[model samples]
Target: MNFWQSFIGGVLPYIAVATLVLGLGYKVTCWLKAPVNLHWELFPYPQTLGGQLSELLSEVFTLRSLFHHNRRLWFPSLVMHWGIYAVVFWLFFLLVGAPVAIYLGTAGGVLALTGSCLLFLFRLFVPGLRQISTPVEYLNLLFIFLLALAALASGALSDLAFRSYFISLFAFKPHLPLPGSYLVFLLLLWLFMIYIPFTRMAHFAVKYFTYHKVKWGEVE
Candidate 1:
């Protein structure tokens, strides 16, 4: 394989994953270890650990409150959120060399692209959202949309050769598969990993702080 291919497909995945794990690990550890302070909020304060867990689960799986308060953005946001989950799970199974993941991942790529497009558009025309939208926020969404698009194209054009390359890497027999159509997609995937910790996407990690710590931990 060429230098760029070898680096992007092999070396950078490790780097990206390491940064994500360590960065978020440090962030969460700090959140938990730090002293708690009182902050006021208006709704649904959990009185017990179970209540906390239930609320967290709802936000993780369904993002329930967004539906009630921001119905216009809710549809695309929820769809894109699930799409991200499926795509991540699909990628995991691909690395594990699972055949079923190929089909599921392809479907996820399509769903992600669809929702990403809607979110991108909504960011433009949704007046309230548009007012607060930052360039970095749009950049993150654009990158996600591009990554999804790349996955869809590579899967269609190269017959899961990209997955095979990754599986090969994990299997200790790294080889660049033919057609090279997935190279850009793989590159974007690594960039996504690297960028995850710094973006609104890292809300996955930060939500823990928000719900259990800042908003509610003051009571504990």
Candidate 2:
């Protein structure tokens, strides 16, 4: 990578993560300081705070969406999401601990690869989804495909492929004999996350906001 690519590949991701964290903090603080209670409805049901907490735990941790939908898309999406979460947790574990995941053997790698492959197939083979998929969607799928591929391949190679590919880029040595399959995938994944917040893909978040605005389950 050149100077700009180095900045983008190395510095931009951290910057984006920082911006996301700080922006979220600022928004929360502003919301707290405001006099108005913005979420008065509690929408579908008026629950006590404890009930809401229990609902949230059930929804997010247990992934209520997948169980509710129980479709091909949901299965792959759930797996890919969990795989990403696992990888992120592992990375944080490495940073704070003694890099214990390196010895996690093939189980972690296999799970990540299978989840990613499922996600890739979901995007590729599902006609209803594929018809509406954009370049960004395809690119995001490609990123996961490569990331999973790299993880699986790295297990068999003696080249320290995952570490060298990223760490080398960080050290300003983009010309290392490292496979860029993972790096490109990661970069594109971050880009997709950044873009999604500003795109129609935000419907994922927006849907919850307006969930009870219209009582669709009942007709007048």
Candidate 3:
């Protein structure tokens, strides 16, 4: 393998995945070590395990409260979230070499990219959200848009025979048949993984901690 191929296909994935795992582990450990708040707590919480589980699932999957609170925000958000879920599933299909990978993955990629673009624009035009939004938030959406855009372009413009490259990587072999556009996407993906634990993307972890320790069920 050449330098680019060797580094991008061979080494970078391991580094990204390792950073993801270690970074998450470190964050969870820090959360666990932090002093617990035994005094103050939220009211009107769920009492039963099933109820709590259902509530958590609804919040995570549907963003139910958003629908009630802000209809305008909810529509675009729902599109973006469902699109993300589809894209994630499509990624799994790709890894497993599923039969329906191409059709479903293409749909997923298009939905995600379109929804992300709509959300990015929405955030810009909404004066209230714009006032509260951080530079990092804009950057995060832009980064996601760039990733999806690159993936879509790679698939559409080039051959994008990514399966063998992925196969080699998973088998701990070395090869890089990726095109230039895909190279951009993969590099961005690696950096995204590395950055996730430090950003608001870590909300998934934080939610687990919050539900188990603070709000509803007691892990202690």
Per-candidate TM vs. native?
0.84, 0.55, 0.85
Residue range 1-220, candidate 3, lDDT tens digits: 4688667767889999899999999999999888667623556677777878888999878888789987767876777677667767766676677756677667766767877787788789989877877889888888778877877777832233566677777788856666666787788778888889889877778876677677653434
**Pairs with backbone N, CA or C atoms under 3 Å apart (clashes), candidate 2:** none
RMSD of 3: 2.8
- The better candidate by lDDT, 1 or 3, is 1
What value of lDDT does candidate 1 attain over all alpha carbons? 0.78
Best by TM-score: 3
Please rank every candidate by TM-score, starting with the best: 3, 1, 2
Instruction: Please report the TM-score between candidate 2 and the true structure.
Output: 0.55
lDDT of 1 by residue, 9-34 (tens): 67887888898998788877877788
- Predicted candidate 2 versus true structure: per-residue lDDT over 83-117, tens digit per residue: 65566655544444434545432344455567667
Models ranked on lDDT:
1, 3, 2
- lDDT of all the models against the reference? 0.78, 0.52, 0.75
Candidate 3 lands at a TM-score of 0.85
Clash pairs detected, candidate 3: none
Backbone clashes in model 1, listed as residue pairs: none
Residue 58 in candidate 2 has what lDDT? 62
Which candidate number would show the highest lDDT if scored against the true structure?
A: 1
Q: TM-score winner between 2 and 3, please give it.
A: 3
Q: After superposing candidate 3, which stretches have Cα over 4 Å from the reference?
A: 38-49, 156-161, 217-220
